[model samples]
Target: MTRLDFELQFARGDFLLAATARIEAGVTGICGPSGAGKSTLLALLAGLLKPQSGHLHFDGDTLIDVRAGHFVPPWQRHFGLVFQDGQLFPHLSVRDNLLYGYKRLSPAQRRFELQAVVELLEIGALLARRPAQLSGGERQRVALGRALLYSPRLLLLDEPLSSLDERLKQQILPFLLRVKTETAIPMVYVSHAQAEVDYLADRVLTMADGQLQPSLATRDAASGLARGSAGL
Candidate 1:
């Protein structure tokens, strides 16, 4: 399994984020209240945001080395991101969106079997519909499928279930669990809810005051108050 190691320092206005952690295979949950830099950290990992100074290494491969003036672009990182909003294109049909990233990949680069992912996410029937035609849960499933179809080395999820109702949360949680047990890809899941962390994460990182509180195993999380800033 590939391990991602990052030591990033970034600041915006009065808020400062300086933290370092190693993310392993399986889901590593980043839990904290709002504005705790969870989203910022994920964005840095995905290369959507550059750190003021730091280095990011994946499985010993250098992705970003600030001192060396090296940085990998977001698309080249091969890290898939799913936000709270599905972020699907309104003009595209479900099939088109799922195929969006997959289509860009060269044939040899395609690691995920299209048919397999389609069945895994149960999105085959929704292909004909547009984004507006699908429910919130259905949209998230499609989003997940699209990301997986790209054959990403790592998956980044930022509060993907936050917008869903209780019923939809229950509906989509199984798919997430399946992804955890059924796939080899590693994931970094960001959320403020302890229930989500308990449910989906094999390990947990607590972020507070724009910093990582401690690198604690999930077992320790339940015993203490998960201290941190509010959501962003």
Candidate 2:
């Protein structure tokens, strides 16, 4: 099913982002080199940037329609975003950081419990520590747990593992895979790492010069990765 339908156009200075896409459930990975406007597209989907003219629909719900002068704000969109840097609150303990957004929602709106997310990410031991006290991978895991605890309808991840070393990336990949398999939450993953995208994305798209297109090669790679990882 089409989870997100986008026909978006936005411009800043000389750069113009003209993109149309139908993102289905599961992970849709956006891969492109630097300056390809991948991040901009994510921002638009996150409702952080309003399109000049276009429509964005999530599950048939209109998120934005330029013609109607309608746009949903980021907080109202129910999208959980995890950026490259982890972006945790420096002073907040890991427990508080996870509770930040989770607490914002009324009990009725809460979908994922704190204990489930903590155990899912295996961050129970780190809860008492602050962001500064954790390692890079541990911090990212905490960030992921925080996002999941928000019970977001969609998760947007932008180069989440880019800052980590190869070993750290390996350490975190399984946790991400577990999230995909266990939570079943739809995700839009943006990264320049082809291999990472291939391993995690069910569908692959490429963004370049403000345009989005399917990457056949990446799609094939993803298929292979899925087959290979089935036993794991």
lDDT value for model 1: 0.85
True lDDT of residue 28, candidate 2 = 84
Q: Give the TM-score of candidate 2.
A: 0.93
lDDT tens readout by residue for model 1, 1-232: 3388778889999989987776667778888999889999999999999998999999888999999999999999888999889899999999999999999899998988778998998988999999999999999999999999998889999999999998999899999999878887788889888788779887788888788755445654454322222221
Off by over 4 Å in 2: 218-232
Task: Please give each candidate's TM-score.
Answer: 0.91, 0.93
Residues 18-54 of candidate 2: C-alpha lDDT, one tens digit per residue: 8887777888888899889998988999999999999
The 0-to-1 C-alpha lDDT of every candidate, in the order given, reads 0.85, 0.88
* Candidate with the greatest lDDT versus the true structure: 2
RMSD of 1: 4.3
Leading candidate by TM-score? 2
